[model samples]
Target: MERKHELNNKKVLVVGLAKSGFAAAKVLVKYGANVIVNDMKELEKNQEAKELINQGVEVHCGSHPLSLLDKPIDFIVKNPGIPYTNPLIDAALEKEIPVFTEVELVSYLTDAEIIGITGSNGKTTTTTLVGLMMENNPKKPIVAGNIGTVLCEVADQTDVDDILVAELSSFQLMGVQSFKPHIGVLLNIFDAHLDYHGTREAYGKAKARLFMNQTEEDFCIFNADDQEVIALVENMKSKKVPFSTKQTLPKGACLNEGFVTFNDERIIAIDEIVLPGEHSLENILAATAAAKIAGADTNQIINVLKTFSGVEHRLQYVDTVEGVKFYNDSKATNILATQKAISAFNQPLILLAGGLDRGNDFDDLIPYLINTKALITFGETAPKLIKTAKEAGIKVIEHVDNVEKAVPVAYECSVSGDVVLLSPACASWDQYPSFEQRGDMFIEAVHKLR
Candidate 1:
């Protein structure tokens, strides 16, 4: 693909030298933009910053000098992780200069259509399902964003004829200005990232940006059962398509008698779906809606639905030890997520729960723990979690400093038929860097039992 000339002769500031920022800076340089890359990490430690310097782009390492923006700049390309509260970002906004993420830059880089998906949960599962559904299409589909691959990394390789399937987050979606996906898929929303977003309403408002720039020609598929999601996008301009698990919708995707359907056309039996939980069922319905709209065959849709087990770290079954099974659902970083994970099991459950204390009351998750064999809590919120379990009449409860210790405790506590589950209902920031790392520890601990 030819370089986009729109950025030529433009002075752009690329903030935060992470993957997204590095990718965006390279793309900008390719388009003849005068790129100045900024990061707080020292130059000796930042390989990406060093690479930018070698490419003739000015590198400002160890700090984001406001002086870098003192010169007239066309716009700022920011890493999605860089918050709006960052002084540079705050300064850019005050100057009326546009600040965007790599996802936005990709929207400008290519004329290809986009299929964007975002939710408090289920975004990865639904996005992966939709990408699989579109993978066989003759037009070609690329899966990127939030699900590991940065959007702009795939942008230059695509053309107007290609389609980009993106798994977006509130962090990514919150940065969009003119960026718009051809098809916007909004899964269920819940209270999340309150530390960053500040309020429940603010978080919802950030999520609502998935449909912000959509036009009449674009499509908006959302969860009909989520009153909060529905309430936010009531006046969206795009064509509204909804998927439901509670009741059959006259339009879009719906569940009826265990069969997933789209506009009354049968797709697959709910039991045939290899992924567990009613949330996964809802994801299938949502994915089917997008897949059918993308012109996937009914037979192909059914095949994928039956074969797709799930994404990693979300309700994933690890190896069993001496007749005791271990499951890794470290992706359940919130109370609602843990609730969904618990609902997927019927076996005797010995649950491992807890994480960073975000001031969340786990009261909502107590009902789901009624018949569990035991509850093992860990991380910063262990005491709070133990109290919740004891109050709910969960007989056996234990607390650990982290998941590394929780695993061994769970192993010793589990009987022959019991399932030891690690589904921490809070973020892993209190101990581990990410939920994936926490899940990895659980997997490592289980493997060590041999």
Candidate 2:
């Protein structure tokens, strides 16, 4: 846990007052860095800003003032979700000042080997599973990044004997410079955050950065089933390890004769796995590949796969109310993610979807809707989703204002053999602060059903 770089008396600007930003500022201060925490919210509303001030770190609230940059700044640790279009970020770049994501900052501060996971979907689940599998490792793996804890918050607590299992996102990977992972996992790439990256190609480039700094000595674990993911690494330099749900790979993880095989070794049976869906299968394969390479034992992999149901909010079963099964997949914040979640079952389905529009085209999901018994829509994208459902020739459709209404109504439209699934193909910001909150509401609503 020794500091790799001296930060004593260095000027560091921690941008955005979110968890990652605040964590980075606290770490910087502990290192004797002169830290300035900037946030757009008013100080009275920003508890994080007040906390940083209490730690002797300077605070700049309300807006990123031009004067904040007037002072000489050393480096910037940015919140992953903060856009480059922010004037403060643009000004920092205009000044040629380097901006770093919390993970990037942690990479320099700790020697603990990183197992970085990234993709449009499944990163959170795969990251959690990998952490669980690696728990039996001597390194004592710690899960961080987009899953919950910012790496900066826990980096100094880890030693060379520890492993940092990070759930990375396109946003986090976009700003990375020298952030290399000893084990890099690319789950699967799809058209996501187009409003942020402006194009699918640009978004793919951001996720591809997860492998940018890896070398021949490092392992790049990727999804071979995803054409985009495979195409994204056509010229990659790292040691390649591909996981697949379809075709069996000669050297990586794959589904071989109903067994989850790792390099031709049968590890676990597909049916015995509690976590359902082909997408979950892919996530397990990816995590298994990464964990095995990271020195996890075969027995450890089998043990975790048989027990690790899933992370919260991704196709998590809520209950069976009146013979209607309820599932929370609120983490399906993109079109493809929702599609994958819904595709998990052959049972009659009452799908509840909608949220912040994000300008996502629902065209790709129409074919998946062909099997739905009913389509309930809500939030900002409700109308669009409803229209797409109708066009797909769905007979039963319901529209509501929010997920609170979508859940109960979806239940009403469901039969005994049907699943009431909340898989919003959009973000939760239109109704709740995060997808977790949205999924929690669905779980709460389902619990209310008699």
Candidate 3:
């Protein structure tokens, strides 16, 4: 790892001790910074904090005491999930202390050429695709960030020749200062994470941060079909590479004569791609543009596209039980995502959906539920989803306790040639800790039916 002289002897405060916070604290110490780690979890409960304390880093746990800021803190490395409304964070901001996520630390730690991907949806899928495409390059590809592995951890091991394919979220992007990517992909934007950002404008600005540090030498691949994405990148300094599913792009990636083409060069046939859903087309175009710019040949991009099905919890096909197929789409945490998942298949769908209600009605989901034969709802949004199902003319509606309970009901409602899909159109926080856990529960429940 490159030694960051800027952090030497600096007193840096790490707020929240999750994976990112823990990684940041360790890296900070390695760069000769006096690290102070803090978390809401008790010190005994926070093994990460305990480990950091052993490394001569000062750690305060159990609570975020306002007194911790009494000392002169150079800056803060905050956990992305922690809101700005946090008492400590608000105070720090008011004091004009610089606050950032671990994402910023990555720019200081690694010399690797970064390819950052961000959007309301398709981030994981697009990042995975770009990672796979860059695998054969002389500079190895390290896929990290919000996809699972923390970017700071990957940055430590990355060399100058390496490429970091990062799946960035608005939460992570909001905290970035000078984090720039050699190739930045903005897939699409929608109304999401309003609770954290408090406004749609804030959310869009956060997503737009991917290209904020890019120069004319860098490349930015964006969705031309999304007007919001278009408007956001109008002033970007990076070379604009537009990808579209709705129209043909003369200079970027787009559909041309039934082929996925880049700059008039045919990459792959539209129908030949293995990943399901029309919504996936946007992800494909964005990844194709990014991969092509990252030195991936037509064959390399085609190879990954033809074979890769999908990322887990995002329309992943599970086992086929009694001639019925099951797809786990627990990652569909919004109406647009659920609409895409439901539209992917033509089979009679027994959709298992519902989770944390973000104060939005399910009216937008009604039109997409036309193919849905039965609706199995759960979590806090069950009533709202049930009403939507009724409006969509879904005759059979079953409100269950959770995803595990909804699976069996979905199977029971299914027949031969039918699909039992778990595509919850809300966040899983209402019942499970994360959408991954909810998807796992659905997978386990599906296996139990066998």
Candidate 1, 84-152: lDDT as tens digits = 899889989999999888877776688888888888998888888888888667768788898888888
Measured with C-alpha atoms, the lDDT of residue 233 in candidate 2 is 83
Question: Would you list the C-alpha lDDT of every candidate in the order shown?
Answer: 0.86, 0.87, 0.91
Reference-based TM-score of each model:
0.95, 0.96, 0.98
User: Evaluated with TM-score, which candidate comes out highest?
Assistant: 3
Off by over 4 Å in 1: 1-3
How far out, in Å, is residue 154 in model 3?
Answer: 0.5
lDDT of 2 by residue, 1-450 (tens): 355457888888888878888888888888788888889899998998888878777888887886788899988888888899888889899999998888777765888898999988888899999998997778899998899788778887888899999988889888888888999999887778888898899999999999998888999988888889889887889999998888978989999999999989899999889888877888899999999999998888888888877779998988998799999999998888888998898998899999897765688899898679889998898889888988898899998878888888887787787899999889999889999999999999999896
Whole-model lDDT for model 3 versus the true structure?
Answer: 0.91
lDDT of 1 at 270: 79
Q: Supply the global lDDT for candidate 1.
A: 0.86
